[model samples]
Target: MSSTPPVPPVVEGGPAGSAPGGSQSGHAEHKFEKWQMKKIPTMWSRTWAHRGKISFGLFLAYSGVNIYYARKQQVIRDTIPQNTILHWRITDGSIVETDTDKGYFQKILRATGGDSPSPVSSLIDVITTIKRAKDDPRIVGIMANFSTANNKTQQTKTLGLAQIQELRSAIQEFKEAKAKALGGEDKVSLIAYTDSFDNQTQYYLASAFDKVYMQPSGSIPLVGLSSTVPFFKTLLGRFGIQVRAEARREYKSMVSPFTETELPPPQKQNLFDLLKGLNSQILADIAKSRQRALGSDPVEKLNHLIQVGPFMGSEAKDEGLVDGLLYKRDCGKLVESNGAFGLAHYMRVTAKEHTNKLAKTGEPSLVVGIVYLIGGIKRGGGDFGANTVVKGIREAANDPTVDAVVLRIDSGGGDVVASDTIGDAIRWCQDEKKKPVVVSFGNTSASGGYFVSTHAKAIIAQPTTITGSIGVASLRPYFTPEFFKLIGVSVEQFFTGSSDTSLLHDLEGAALTRYKRQIDATYSDFIKRVADGRKMTIEQVENVAGGRVMNGKEALKAGLVDKLGGLSYAVRLAGDYGLEVHKNAGHLSSDMEIENIVVKVFPTPKPYLQQIVESMVGDEAVDMYVRDKIHSMIMRVWTGDMMGLLHEVGLSESSFQNAPVSERILDTLDTELNPDNSDIPDTVEVDEFDEIVSGVESVKSLEHDCDIRALCIVGYTRRKSQSNNCCMRGVEDRRLRMLFEQM
Candidate 1:
């Protein structure tokens, strides 16, 4: 079935016509043909013979493409345009203490522009750019766009008033540098352009600039500030939920919302004082900034303006609140008449100039470490973890290269014990490691935040910073079974002991008495810490104690703070102190000057690949991903909605973001007081105060440190002997279980 061609057979000589000489010639010719076939090469053989040449060709192509990009980037770096206006669009989530602290996934998201990088600019970035521009001949002006600086919708990411003050301080520095450079009036213009001024804080920032322009359609709501507190006692009572709480003093209003239907007299007075102090600050700053424009009586004029109304663009211009009324595009044109570039672009182009200084030989360099502790202080790892902060400080302490540490803190406080943990670490860093630790308070470093900063070499806070609040409070909620019964959900209690310490039941009798004792001990410890650190008597500390929140100025006067300034001042002071240490040790000559002050931020940023891996599998990722899923499932099962789950768990969204950090801490502590695990040990040792210090050691870093002094009390009179009475033995057994379960 196949069509095939047959091969010709080889013959010994020429076929048919044969002479002996012809046969010999044919055989020679066949041998020659076989040799020729062996000499010629196939395509595969040729390619194999010249493999190096092909690889070289590929390498050259790659090198050429890389060279092209390198050269292109270099050109941009070399030739930044002259008379450039640096545009700073300070949008929501734009300001941070250190940009490099972001994790790898966040950087990649920013780099890819997938999430549209949120105009982020660190405090150092803005300050450095302005500082460098002050001397740069090419930079003629700075145009700040604050249209998105205070995003109302994204309240968590919005700029704080203290941050605004920090930026304004940088602007002030720029102006001073410009004046010194010109040896005359500052020629460089600092202009602020926004679509609108929504509040006094925004206007307060704009007031610092030489020229403030607003879109004609926009309005300036330069209204004063007001404080509001919501009481949930009546609302919770409707559901038969009662809160049992205690504060060391009356002014510790952290427990007020749960305990009272309305603001108590002490809380009302405390809030009023805070508002009054803050208002005085606002009035003073605005008056100073707009003094010339207001002619005489600037403070009086500002007070009248704030009281009268929020003004339209034209009205604001007329009232001297704004310099002009202009559209965003027109304002941009005016500022960028010569040339313009973004703050990022300018920094990129000039980075080589800054970096080259680092390479200079024979320069006296001072290394200062910067640690950002910016959130509610707690335990475990996060933005404001006591452990995380301790690690950063210890990293600086361990590093020979790090001469001093600058702790930049922005928090409203969280856990007292955790705060003390951080404070102890700071003490170790300074006293044991011989390092100077200076604190720079940001917007809201109060209570536990200040507690951690107590042992620092120096403390600096911006005039607008909210600080102080030196008192302790604790709250525990009890859910009545009667409420569940009313909702057709009967609850029953089953225990093999005489007592139950469950959150469902209220603490009373001995338990309540012991809780108050714990509060007193903590308050006394707080007072002692403050008195020792601030070099004040017990009475002096007590006067500023009692949970009274003060602005930076008042705190400085009260001796709670050493100075009133910003982060820059703190860094400088830290450097000076380091230099002083060196001088006293005979390391530096009196005539010698520091050529550079290098700020090394701690803890060093993690590698990019690690960041990526962590983003996927890290504890934070797991907590967020798994916890959200579990929360969602539970919400669906109960209410068929996921929104009110936080509220149901005794927390609202505001409690997470805006509540006194103690509120969140108390909520977490309430859970740890009574746990479901039953493998608890039968016996544990108690300390001299009848406190289980050993038990405290066994506790892992919690979200916040629970006040275990009272919670750790055993039921049998804190003795090791077995209880002979049956009821006492039962009580002892139950309390022992509660004690270890807390851990």
Candidate 2:
């Protein structure tokens, strides 16, 4: 009423006192405010609620899928019959012979992300399971799926021909024993499956099987043979990566790959001779299999087939290269259909039967032990390394029942010390236990692999087996200047003695001379070892010591091998030795410790929430991510070494697969020891007492009393230093102290 008294005039579009437009605008604002008030809260609540529901639903779905898959797998496993079919999946490198229930469990654990079990344990489990099934009356036949090839090189190197032959021999022996127990009936059938066969090593294995099947889409690449090594000196000239190499012998072609543009005349001639010999063997085997009189002319026929077109599955069968073309699933069905039960059902039922068979009939009264030396000859124990083989040999020697031993070697060599250790083990087995040892070559038993095998009583090799590489060489790239220039990384060293930290730098002048001298000494040791084992003069060993590659025929002629046979021949020799030992003895005990259980199981304590969180966010995650990064970086470095500029421009076939825990640990160790880092973690507290004691014992056994005394004195000095420091000493301290004071 008071404002009305002061009534003001309204303008056309001026303010609240204006005409129609002003009033309408005010009304529209009021309406919008009311609408927003009604809609905002409702929309916000719905979106938030729906998002949570969707997330929960997705989580439930993922859990359901995992549960369904797990249950289905369990049901399938339970439904399968026992002792039906044994599927041996051959994995290269750390190939575990998983044919037993325990082996299966271990493999499943490894596949799922559990601690990896040792390869021997896996093999032992398979053997135990097979033995148990063999004794079960419900079991009918045994079948195997062999997919491993001896030639495929791994991180550990290729499987030696001797090892493959031994494995084949062992399988045969097991089959024969099972058949005899089953009233002389052939209840076992060996079946091999592969995409195609090319190398002589694989072909030899396929020939052992009762029936070999090839995939319809796969071609048996049975082209004669060729070994090509393209030198890249010219290619690298453009990039300025000059390669300097030296070798002792004219035939040594190990350095040819990096130095030459193509094979040298002598290398070419050697390869041609090797190809001619290998081709003859391949044709002979094919002719025997197909019942054809094909001779050296088979190469021409093979060439004609390739020129026409890529052969299909049925075409391969028609050409007599394969027995039949079948899909993997169809092959499984065929195996199942032949028996009274289905494949899955048979596997379940027969698994139990075989387990019982293996248990009842243990190893024979006179045990003939066979040690598998497969893969690269690494320094450490486990799998196909030198330490593993040596350990196995020692175990066999200690066993009174083990009258003879067979070494199945398949490798291209690795560390020199590892090879020497294995050789020493073999010598110990022969001299101490007086056990006759036979060696069988599978694919390639060259260098360190051959070094160990030369100590055996008899050596057997396949026709295509590659042997002989008595040489030593090493290459280490230096990135000091490059890394400093590219990244701001820097390194400095302080030394108190001559040659201190010398190995850390590039090899040049005095350093290079020292390195060469070390290599020569190692080479001399290698030659001496071979000469001792082969009972030849050092001069004779030197003739073949310059890293010369030899096929089985040439190796045999050179007195590197004694027989042209497989693992079976080696085992048979072992059995003969065992029989001889038994005959010489008055009586033998019936009971024997056939197996030793080395596996242990314990329940894992529930992890605390904090522990789990820390593991996820702390060192573990950093370790994993950093390791993967480093592995990729290292692989890139290696590719650079192998392909030079090609890799730099992304034209090389280099890859970094999932990084392993071991690689990560190595990276962490490398980082911690980096020279630029001032604060290095103290590793002195680690309890390496057992390792020290073991090393001392091993040295005593390998060397003279004078050497043992020297080692003991060195150990005393190191112990005194550690006592004085009050701080823990590490591997470096022990190594350096030993070097200065002892051998």
What digit string (tens of lDDT, one per residue) describes model 2 on residues 500-522? 23533566898778767887888
Model 1 misplaced regions, further than 4 Å: 1-59, 62-66, 108-118, 150-156, 183-186, 349-351, 493-501, 616-743
Q: Where is the poorest 10-residue window by lDDT in model 1? A: 714-723
lDDT of 1 by residue, 136-255 (tens): 877777888877555543322656777878878788777777766656545777889999876677788788888889988888887777888999999888888889988868788899
Query: What RMSD does model 2 have?
Result: 19.9
Identify the candidate with maximal lDDT: 1
lDDT for each of the candidates?
Answer: 0.73, 0.57
| Candidate 2 Cα misplacement greater than 4 A, ranges | 1-106, 109-218, 226-244, 292-309, 322-364, 381-386, 476-514, 579-743
lDDT of 1 at 529: 89
